[model samples]
Target: MKRREIVEKKKAISEIIKAASAPEKDHLCLFSQFRHYQYKGHSFYLKSGRGDKLSSILKHHIQNILKINMEKVYGSEWPSEEKSKRKEMVSPEARYIFIYETANSDPNQMSESVGGRGSQTVCANDTETIVGFVHFRFTLEEEVPVLYVYELQLEPHVQGKGLGNFLMQLIELIACENRMSAVVLTVQKENLLAMNFYLSKLRYTISSISPSRVNQLTGPEKSYEILCKVFGVEAKAVLEVIFSIANSAY
Candidate 1:
């Protein structure tokens, strides 16, 4: 198919969402080999999951990880930022790949129980040890289908390992498999480590839609920047190129 046609078809966000969420039997089957990863004497497994199916315990785990890692970055806005993060994490459209350490761990014990807002049936017996998680979703950006990574939080103990890079590679593969135009994510300017990781290590460009690129004056006022790694000509044109300047921010 022509690049224009692909971009035209993806204009319908519903279709992209449907295609991405349809693979229910084995969501990560296309990238099965990535499910297992080892680095720095640490072994871990990635489990595909949905936001709506997150157990109360898993929700707690995600919250704790985000706090420990992002509170300093968000500073005084941490409270409101955390609230937004919680809501986004439970959206039905959100998808996740949870990472768990696999040393002497029973496969059966790593089950996820379904729970969400107002879910009173909390599973106190849950004991899965999650070291990190990648939250993402299929969404429309500049009228093109793309995968937006909402969060990539890891425990302090696991920060220096190559796990972050490996997970991003898997995310890119998933984006390609789903015919996504690009892999997009936002990074706080204050978080220099994360900014360097995406911009320098991953080579993701500062998207044209990013606040910084949108307007040279007010752009610097924004706290974060949107970055993307585009896949095709259509994606590059719509997401990476700056055709005209307008009063907008992404």
Candidate 2:
């Protein structure tokens, strides 16, 4: 990319973040069908969340879910990782899609009524309960505008029911709708299930910026790998191919 082009791209990404961060209905409205999800006998609805606006109830759920799912994976590193997660969850730029299990008679009908941007839609009833969440943000990765997923956690009871795949598909849709180059996330190398889910099920590739792709020798020492599903040739070059050249230089 040319210097001027990179500058323009950065400006564009900044504007996207600003607009998405605003308490208004816009890009999300483009895909209203994804607001509700039903799998097996379970019915759930998604709610948009801002890091700054998280209620005590939501915050409690976030922390509890993270610990339940990640403590064993992080092991000795969990204490510090937990602190980091707490701080990241509160950043003003952090955006969330919270999944709540609902008691509504027909979830298919709920999907018809809910809009994309939660700011414009009231969601769930008094009987609905929280189940899982996906935390993501609109930001730049290697000067390319992308949606970075910070976390995707589900309650233990909901695992292995294809809900993870459904949520990821929704996230990818939102990324594409917003003109993001790709959907990016990090996964611990120790978490085999998640790695297989993203790589085999979702078809995401290890990003060029991932430690292993950047330097195979020392990269394996890193506990995590960055992964992405690129949308176009430009994103593929910057996110998946750039490090191939970088590795040669190393």
Candidate 3:
């Protein structure tokens, strides 16, 4: 082969290596940009995680957020006992909470009840405080990878600002990057606002519904719906755009 042709071939290989090794700029961009929407003087910022101090400020306000939804749906305070039991059930398979401390801890040293693969926590910045959080868990089902939105909550003061929709879009992007076939989540039927948010705006389809018969004997049986969305086509479309941009740069 001619020397010039050989040199050009080496350069093309180098470009491919550079693209594969370095993280995409879009990943960082998503984490940094917040689609701003305001209510009164308060502004909202949706992003993944936050500094330790900011997370601390939002911890106490979580209950206030939980209480608002609980009251509206059940006409009573969220039952601490029931919440504990539910946490205990899932603890065997995954840690219920995700934060710096939990993430930094050694998996072997942690209790069997805590920790799971691909679990992360994200915070929503509201003015000077962190007003909400979302917990994500990724798992493989029947050899196909899927991302699960285990939990999402916003402080009572920050609701109705369109932050939830923004966060959902971010989750979808992350799932696409990870090559997940679909995103799945379970929500209580009583939480009508959440039900509507997932179904109407996010385009999630209900896959199943299970009612708690055990709880029915004691009081009310809470029904839960499982929802999922396939992302194969969407992810391919996004990757095509990224590849086109990289090719243009070369």
Question: How many backbone clashes does every candidate have?
Answer: 0, 0, 0
- lDDT for model 2 comes to 0.80
| Candidate 2 residue lDDT tens string, 55-132 | 877798788989999999999999999999999998988888877877674754553343434343345442237788
Question: Which digits, one per residue and each the tens of the lDDT, describe model 3 over residues 1-250?
Answer: 6999978855664554344223222222444343233445554433333222233444445444555545455544347634753343233222122112122122333322212332223322332354666656556533345666766767665678766776777777766665566777777776777877887777676542212322335423455656667767642332212211111111
TM-score of each: 0.83, 0.86, 0.52
Q: Best candidate per TM-score, number?
A: 2
Lowest lDDT block of 10, candidate 3: 241-250
Candidate 2: the clashing residue pairs are none
- Candidate 1 similarity to native, TM-score: 0.83
- lDDT by residue (tens digit), candidate 1, 173-210: 99988878899999988898898888778888889899
- Over all chains combined, what TM-score does candidate 3 have? 0.52
Clashing pairs in 3: none
After superposition, the stretches of candidate 1 with alpha carbons farther than 4 Å from their true spots are 1-13, 23-25, 105-127, 242-250
* CA RMSD of each candidate after superposition: 6.5, 4.4, 15.5
Deviation from truth (RMSD, Å), model 3: 15.5
Give candidate 3 regions above 4 Å deviation: 1-30, 35-41, 50-58, 71-77, 80-82, 85-128, 208-222, 233-250
